[model samples]
Target: MAEVEDLLEGVTVRLSAAEEIRAKGRRRRARGRAVRVGAGGAALLAAAGAWMLLPPGDRGTRQTVATATANPFRTDGVIQMPRADELPGYARWHWTESAGLPAGAGRRSGPLPQVGLAEACPASFAMTDEPGQERYSLLYTGRDHALAQYRVIAYDDTATARSQVAKVREQMTECGLRAVPPTARESEEGSRAWSGTVQDGRTMRVTVRRWNSWVSVAEVLDGTPAD
Candidate 1:
């Protein structure tokens, strides 16, 4: 009976060793699959990153994303003036024969000269052409033969525009100009504006507005007294 017990123990030990070898083989296969899956995942992430870093083409939809997201009120660091043709009616107005006033005519020190029909401060105007300052102006005539002036002035930033607008307002007040209440229909394009009637015999609707980096002034004669 002792010999039989010893033989059974040896057989049991052999079976256990075979099972251990099979288990090690299964573990190795599972580890190999895990490593392969990890490598595949890493490759996918690398490919995605590479695609994200690709440059956008000139005509690609992404090319306009920056412009679309940009603020319209922002100045492009270039002096921009509204064109005479951009007036209310394309055919109702025509450009004057003259090239318009000098560059610095809008400055406080350089008032616009009283040209034949044009008056100084036809519309309240302020601008600077110092090293970093920029401004532009355009003049037009409506079908009724009334003079219309448009001015665009750029500043270092929105804060500067605001300060400049205030200064112009103070100057206008000191000049004894009368303020006209702006109509609710007036559009300022997300900017600060002051509208008034300059009591110079002929009624004029003058507007001064300030946006992100620009100040714009427009004046139109009402063709009547402001009584």
Candidate 2:
């Protein structure tokens, strides 16, 4: 009976040792799985941080889309005169908006048919005036022997601008101002020129031009009239 008891005790001790080995193997496998999961989470976090640190211009397609959404394209609708240096002649001339006398003011001398007529004259382009018409003028001076005036007139439509030019042309003939070839750089569709000696004998030249719904009148007086 004592020998049988000894054998059963030995069998019980062997069984307990095998159970301990199995438990150790399970714990090692669970620790390996946990390490792999931690490594994958750290890699994902590194990638996210790198993307956040990139420059705005290097942000690629997202940056371009955001910029286009902020500012939209626009068309210029306002009319502006040329700068003083942009004029054809002397670049050092002084320019002032809405300055100087009107185009033909006080320079007309004559026994012409329209001499005593009202202000509806070609030299001033008064026929181009209307209710919604816009007009801008710049006087240019500072040269030793010359004086200039630049004028711009805007109408509602191109057709009305053409009509205005035609009326001025007809009045110019009736007013005895001979038509000369255009010499001004602003010459366009309805360009017309007239030159004559003013009351004081200074050479006065007037050039009128039409561009779409706009008209430009350029007047130049070269050399002073002798007193």
Candidate 3:
């Protein structure tokens, strides 16, 4: 069996390469050159960039934004996570730095963010390039106990977002760490929800939804997770 460290290393390498690509992209945008050149490429870029300009209410479908109470901002690289008052039990949410992940990669504590999920089941669930991605978790203040996590990823198109959601649904079945009964449902037309337990025995309710070209994943534990 592959060790967790090995899997993390692989993810780190890929993320590093992705960061380089994004950096180049930033420079290109700085020069004010067309992001995608030649033959209808401009049209494609327009479509991809349109999501960023959409108003909060116009961003999502009939389904609410996954487990989040608010719509995620479309600004690239800016993570607008739910605030303390926004989350009933959580006093505050904090950013977590994962081992082997590039400083640019978004990560947090709570219910094992996306990087942790990839480490747990590398073959089944792995990280991929995105226009922008971020993770956040509830701050563990030692007194108040709450386990909640959130990840938001932006893609170039809705198709890519849909594909990610499908992969997550599939992971719920393929990964053997599942302890909680895997229940998958479409809370609304364009949203999905799944509940399962990780190896540490945290019963988590994960909700996924896509709006335009963005996808959000929220994980809220049924109770305080094992320490």
Which parts of model 1 are misplaced by more than 4 Å?
A: 1-98, 101-117, 121-131, 143-145, 178-185, 191-199, 222-227
- Give residue 100's lDDT in candidate 2 (0 to 100): 53
Q: Considering summed lDDT, which 10 consecutive residues are worst modelled in model 2? A: 109-118
lDDT of 1: 0.52
Error of 3 at 212 (Å): 1.6
lDDT-sorted candidate list, best first? 2, 1, 3
Error of 1 at 92 (Å): 8.4
Candidate 2 residue-wise lDDT at 86: 58
Compared with the true structure, the alpha-carbon lDDT of candidate 3 equals: 0.49
> Please, what are the lDDT tens digits per residue for candidate 3 over residues 23-98?
9889879666553454368777788789767776776642444545544444465566655444323434332322
Model 1 agreement with the true structure over 75-115: per-residue lDDT tens digits? 58555555666543335445452355333333222222111
Residue clash pairs of candidate 3: none
lDDT of each: 0.52, 0.55, 0.49
Q: Model 3, 157: alpha-carbon shift in Å?
A: 1.1
